[model samples]
Target: MRIEKHPILTFERGKEIYFIFDGKRIKAFEGETIAAALHADGIIKYNTSPKLHRPRGLFCAVGHCSSCLMTVNGVPNTRICVTRAKEGMIVHSQNPRGDLND
Candidate 1:
């Protein structure tokens, strides 16, 4: 569920758009980050831990952490938390630490 109202913040959204996540179409807005859109669409698992292979999700929304890394349009290790969601963009969940040569 989106936070429509807050005591100290305001939200301004852009036009509606759609992106591919793991071969599934996800609804999003132009200005929202991929992680935000995924979260809004009820997708919480972004990746997995490198060693333990545990599920990972959004940790830092400001692009300062690796917890939100994923593959976007064939580019691996993309920080979806800071990358803006675009129409028809392809996103995929990474495998463990992610592959840079992908």
Candidate 2:
């Protein structure tokens, strides 16, 4: 599921693309952020806390905080909140140990 309509920002519909997450294929709109796409898909837990292992979501829409960190296309320490989603881009949640392919 994706955000069909947004309140503030007008969603510019873009080309469809497929990406793999946890071995499952998912669709994302072109030029959308990975965090936005995931959030639209009902995925809030982007990463776990390093110490307490508490699930973390998007705190700041910008890339100031480390809350919305995820692995993008096998790259670790990716800030999904700011990173724009592209066609065929893969996004994975980071574990407590900062592992993406766990």
Candidate 3:
């Protein structure tokens, strides 16, 4: 969920845009991070751990961690938490090796 109104901070949401996530269309705002859009759209599962195959989601919100890694426009291991959401972008959940169709 997005905080539209905040006491300390302000949210300057841009024009609404659409993107493809795992073949499903998702709504997002311009300049917002991909992870933020996904979370706002109720998508919490970003990827799975490479070894144990456990579920993983956004952890650091920064680009320093792999928890938010996923394939964006066929690019694997992309840090979605810091990646800006764009119109018509293709995103897919990573497999055990952090890749889709790899």
Among these predictions, the greatest lDDT belongs to: 3
Model 3 misplaced regions, further than 4 Å: 99-102
Q: How many residue pairs in model 2 have overlapping backbones?
A: 0
Candidates 1 and 3 compared by TM-score, better number = 3
Worst 10 residues of 2 by lDDT: 93-102
Best by TM-score: 3
At residue 49, give the lDDT of candidate 2. 86
Residue pairs with backbone atoms closer than 3 Å in model 2 (clashes): none
Model 2 TM-score? Answer: 0.79
- lDDT tens string, model 3, 1-102? 788789999888999999999989999999999999999999998887989999999999989988988889989889999999999999888887654455
Q: Rank all candidate structures by their lDDT, best first, as comma-separated numbers.
A: 3, 1, 2
Local accuracy of candidate 1 as per-residue lDDT tens digits, 32-84:
99988999989998777888989889997999988988889889889999999
Model 2 lDDT on a 0 to 1 scale: 0.77
Model 3: weakest 10-residue lDDT segment is 93-102
Per-prediction TM-score to the true structure, in the order listed:
0.88, 0.79, 0.91
**Off by more than 4 A, model 2:** 1-10, 97-102
- Superposed model 1: Cα runs more than 4 Å off: 5-10, 100-102
Q: Over the stretch 1-102, how does candidate 2's per-residue lDDT look in tens digits?
A: 755678898767788876766566667778777777777778777677888988788999889988887778888888988888876677777775555455
The CA lDDT at 17 in model 2 is 77
Which lDDT values do the candidates have, in the order given? Answer: 0.89, 0.77, 0.90
Counting clashing residue pairs in each candidate, in order, gives 0, 0, 0
The predicted structure with the larger TM-score, 1 or 2, is 1
